[model samples]
Target chain A: MTPDQILTPILDWLDLAGVAVFALTGALVAARLNQTFVTMAFFALVTGVGGGTVRDLLIGAPVFWMQDPWVASVCFGVALIAWFTPQRWWEGDGIEYADAAGLAAYAVLGSAKAFAFGVALVPAAVMGVVTGCVGGIIRDLVAGRPSIIMRPELYVTAAAFGATLCVIGLSLRIEQTVVWSVAALAGFTLRAAAIRFGWA
Target chain B: MTPDQILTPILDWLDLAGVAVFALTGALVAARLNQTFVTMAFFALVTGVGGGTVRDLLIGAPVFWMQDPWVASVCFGVALIAWFTPQRWWEGDGIEYADAAGLAAYAVLGSAKAFAFGVALVPAAVMGVVTGCVGGIIRDLVAGRPSIIMRPELYVTAAAFGATLCVIGLSLRIEQTVVWSVAALAGFTLRAAAIRFGWA
Candidate 1:
């Protein structure tokens, strides 16, 4: 089936790449908390896909990771890099900007998947929110730190706005690349704004 | 009709109490991470019901938390407690033991629910493990910490052992209380042992 025809995209390539990016974000955060290498890998894997798994389960879709090996494999690779070079990747690395990028990626990916699964508009929007937020939610709870949801930051709001716009665009059958680009930009803009203004 | 006669457990007060206990553990852990009130509540809700949600999805049972508002209410209560008395409840006194107790309660609760949903031995065992571990996994990732699953720790092992004993007792036609006692004790013992011996 064409990628357009697929509901839950096994984004043969982007999915793998997405996993690496999200895992890197997860691993870097865990490293900052002083976790062991094994712990870092676990966090990366869980954070990278936690939201997607929940969305899949809610929609009665096959759990995404169980359907493919690449998700786990990519996370492993990301973890190895993080463990070997935390200082290079995490410390003094404009991490806030990196995290903002990761958030934008997560928002777009989550929105796209939920829409594909035949979730209703509101629920799809919710799923997108969940997908973007849940991994960090899990990470913070385990690390015993404040999570994004608790902070008045723009994290979830940014994701929601992007997801809503994406859903609206898809409903109107707008061009896919155009819809994605707009959503991604909106997410980035909101996150950047929050960070710059030191919004709570 | 017996408790298992109807698949939905809406009237089961024990289940409500069970969710409260589950949320308590989540809240306690979140509090340790210094999460804000909202994050603590969200964590509590997810932690309390996360295992069952995963079990239901895998086994084709209805996700219990979505159908019940009591679980959410209970989690709110736990979050309130954790937030209002963060130091006392999560850090000030005897919090480690509280954590152990929470682990024991959830392990048994998860296993019994799995059995009631007609899961077989291995899947039920897996469900037990999932229930015990997933909330903590999410908690760690969101907190920017490493998850327990990646650790050489005894957490999953202990939960599995407890779940196994619970299943065994059920097969042997033991009393519910007897089985629960056995399972909770087994879980607590293993966890305590791990904490004491520094086992991963």
Candidate 2:
């Protein structure tokens, strides 16, 4: 397959992974609310898709989901899983791991999309910041907690660091895969460590 | 008064009124969630402030709340009222009116801010739509419901009409109070009429 063909599928997977992880966090929050299964699924779907939609609209791009139905499909599929699965799987002690994954995945995807759109480095980084945190911000606000903006563990800062690194790596002509892997790792690691140590 | 003095107080009152109205809705939602009064207040403050913060950041302006404490103060005052008042006042009897007020106030402020930032007509309209809708969008997401985006309604369309009128009024050299009064009236009228009659 040509490079153009390869790029589309790779980007799709990254976006899908981001959506799935966000869905998990949404489902978890809904469960915490003791919401019904349908509500849980709906929350997960919105949380999964919300950030990217905002990003596309801001950048004047056709909304990604409207163009490629796969993104919505992934969210729908995750909602089904979250609905049908036994509560124990999500509610178990390992929930933090899933939260960390969601954070990292969305951050990197946000940065990548910005880079793809040729946004300036700073604005791109801000896009990454918004993408990574806004969903969770919305989640916590409705759930009636102080937003992560009020938290001390450097949530947006971590996303910024990873996004900057990815952008720099791309500018320096590094391999795309390597840049994304490193960026995602950076975000995931910071979140994982923070959760483990109760840093926030 | 010079432009700075004249505009500052005007912007402040708009922000205050908008914040209070949005805060009322947030607090009302929290009350419905069976959250404690403190939680309700916190949601009120966040929802009242979140859209403005996001809008400022997007437009490369100082976030209005951080620059002035009065916005937060008004939000708290509104939250107190929301909390101390009887639940039935909001839960059934007054929610529609409060929501209509919110929809109007925020939409006008958002559009005005966009024009102040020198955004063009299309982007400005986009700003108005986002300004009017995003607060509720964020609030509903956090509260876990189908947001404006998912709803079949004239929510955005109403904001568009009001925002467009504001821009056109400005272009035609309409007086400032006249401009905002018309915009707010248009937004409220559109929203209330639609909600009351189940008009889409």
Candidate 3:
């Protein structure tokens, strides 16, 4: 099979996985704020789908969440999980690790999708960063907190690294599966290090 | 002529007018924050196009600003105006009045476009409010300020009034010109009154 054919199925799972993790973070934020179930669900939904929605819009594609019934269901289900679980369960660096993983995967997925949609290489990479970061930014903004971007974190930088690597790999006609895996790993490693070592 | 045909030409003008006024408000906000010229321009562009961009994305339309050459030009030009002019020039209720006008016109145009794109009635009205308010919401969020939605203003209510009216008129087969004019005027009147009388 061609690279795209092989990557398509994997991308689907990655998309759902990223959405669930992001949604969990969103719900957790609401839970910490003592918000109601409805508010938590809303937060989950927006955080899960915000980045992909922006990417789709910029690429002139149908919105990913609106088209997929399963996406909103996943967000709500994640919210329900967050609502019932004790905050201690999600404490420590676990969620941050998961977030880093999601950021890397999402960045790769975003750039890959953009490239597939005929976007130029640089813009495709930028789309990757946007897809990974915009959701959290939106979540923070609506919650009236300082957004992640305002912090001197390497959050966006990690996403951009993966996204840019993916685009470059695609342009070099590398195998899609290898490119995605390597790029995501590289990004995750960087982000994980940042979280673990307090890298700015 | 069909309502759409008659409204099309007028909608174009309304769109630009709305963009210019909203951009001014956005730039003004950045200026108040003592941001750089670049920040002011960025604020202007986002505030001017944020609502329409969201509307187009939701309705599966090509983003209006991306397709239009003049839209970004208009936003940047307005930013320049805000940058060079004294702050006192934009002080008082003048900008608020202009903002009210833009809000109403934009709401009408947003719903009209959504309706044309075959979105259903209530959702179309929601689109109008989104188009009218999201830009400012984004601006506030990025500026790390409490968003206007947090206030008890009649801002969104007025936009909804205009948007819902436009859709209802369209559904009832009212003349396009009359529908747009009446809807815009109704919204502007309410907003103006709120500004003048300090109505919440």
Cα distance off (Å), candidate 1, residue B197: 4.8
Q: Model 1, range B1-200, lDDT digits (tens) per residue?
A: 64456534432454566566667767877777777788888888887777666766765566776767677788798789777763664453254455555566666766676777566654455556677677777666666666666566777667777877887787678987889788889898888887777876
Q: Rank the candidates by TM-score, best first.
A: 3, 1, 2
What is the per-residue lDDT of model 2 for residues A1-200, given as tens digits with 9 covering 90 to 100? 64335556776677777778887787777776666554564567557766776776666554555435366456657767777777788765476677667667677777777777778777777777777777777666655567787889857777777777777887788998898899889988887777777776
lDDT of 2 at B187: 86
Comparing 1 and 2 by lDDT, which wins? 2
**Cα deviation in Å at residue A11, candidate 1?**
4.0
Model 3: what TM-score? Answer: 0.61
Clashes of each: 19, 1, 0
| Index of the highest-lDDT prediction | 3
Query: Would candidate 3 be rated incorrect, acceptable, medium or high by CAPRI criteria?
Result: incorrect
**Predictions in order: lDDT:** 0.71, 0.72, 0.87
Error of 1 at B72 (Å): 19
Best by TM-score: 3
lDDT string, candidate 3, B1-200, tens digits: 65456556777788899999999999998898776665676678779988888888888776666545577678879989999999999999999999999999999999998888789999999999999999999888888877989989999999999999999998999987899899999999999999999999
TM-score of each: 0.57, 0.55, 0.61
The DockQ of each candidate is 0.12, 0.04, 0.14
Candidate 2: where is the Cα deviation over 4 Å?
A: A1-200, B1-6
Candidate 1's error at A187, in angstroms? 1.5
